[model samples]
Target: MMYDQLKVLEKTIIDIKKKYQLVNDELNSLKQKPNTDPKELAALKTQLSNYRNEHDSAKKQLGDLDKRYQNLAEAHHMIGEEQDKLHKQLADLQRKNSELQQHNDQLKQQNHDIKQQNHDLQEKNQLAAERTQVVLKRLTRIDQMEG
Candidate 1:
């Protein structure tokens, strides 16, 4: 029975000490609260509002810069596509130029062949005229002998 009474007394002492600590903490908080002046609080509020405006302005400027960067990226992509198109056109033109060169070479060869044929025909015509002259001379000699 005595032991139980001692336990109850010890518990009461612990609870009282906890209550005293809580009251002291509350008193200290109240003392500090009174030291914060209204003017200082207003000044802090104004500074916070200015910082908020500056932050918002910076965020808007960043958004505009991002938009400009995206536009530049799109323009660069379009330029790349145009460059590819020009390259393909250049290749096609090169192919056409080679084909034209081949056709010109064939025409030159045909002209050379025609000139050779004309030379051969002129030589044959000269030989036939010489044979006719020889035959006429022989006929004139025979007539003179018969007379």
Candidate 2:
């Protein structure tokens, strides 16, 4: 699951980078175009300004995603360590007495809950990825029309 999430993160970074380059190239192209009419030039300038805003917004979002990914990774590591500690405690309890069986069962349930939470996180990440893809496609379509 970590590997899958890593792959998705990597792909998202690549997609964002490509989009950034495309927007940069488009801006350069628009700037190089000669316009004799002041009104048309103003319109182009407005459009360019809009594009720049959108690009900046995208960059901020990418940064936000990177931060989220880092947080998730840290949480994952912490959870693993917690699970290991739980496993050790459970084993020690088992060796100490049969009365601790109830405690063991509770720990198992806690582990189950943790696993569910992890699964939910994964689902949320997947949904975020889908939304990102949709946004990217829409941006591409807009770029095509503008071009």
Candidate 3:
């Protein structure tokens, strides 16, 4: 987009330059022409004055356009820098996501191991309860004989 604007500005500058040169040449030609009639000379002077005014106006416009073009170029450069920063941010986020995924996988494996350990503890508790029950029954029988 900036390139296109610059191209258009360059073309406008070229056109304005051509017009200025043409006006200058015309004024010079009028100066060289041999004049007899005062009225004709006055008319030529008026025409030259008009041409000079037009040239001055064109020059002012060209200056304004040049300033605008410079501003646009600066804006374009800033936009490019911003784009580069955003691209870097995107890349960093992607890398962080990858690391998080790896961490999540590790946590999942740990969870599975903890569940297996819980199951083993439950089985051990059941066996201990059965042994206690058997010992109680044997003690009750012994107590009755003693009574």
Q: Can you tell me which runs of candidate 3 are displaced by over 4 Å?
A: 1-3, 134-147
Worst ten in a row by lDDT for model 3:
25-34
Most TM-score-accurate candidate: 3
Instruction: State the number of backbone clashes in model 1.
Output: 0
lDDT, candidate 3, equals: 0.93
Encode model 3's per-residue lDDT on 16-82: one tens digit a residue.
9999998889888877888999999889889988988898899899999999998998999999999
lDDT of each: 0.71, 0.90, 0.93
lDDT of 2 by residue, 1-147 (tens): 876887898798899899889988988997788889999989888988898898899899899889978988998999999999999999988787776787888999999999999999999999999999999999999999999
**Model 2 spans > 4 angstroms off:** 1-6, 90-147
**Candidate rank order under lDDT:** 3, 2, 1
Model 1 lowest lDDT segment of ten: 1-10
Could you report the Cα RMSD, in angstroms, for every candidate shown?
24.7, 42.0, 2.5
Which numbered prediction scores highest in lDDT against the true structure? 3
Clashing pairs in 3: none
In the range 2-100, model 1's lDDT, one tens digit per residue, is 345445545655655565566557545654664477887677567556655655565565565556556666777798899999999999999999999
Candidate number with the higher lDDT (2 or 3): 3
Task: Kindly indicate the candidate among 1 and 2 with the higher lDDT.
Answer: 2
How many pairs of residues in model 3 come into backbone collision? 0
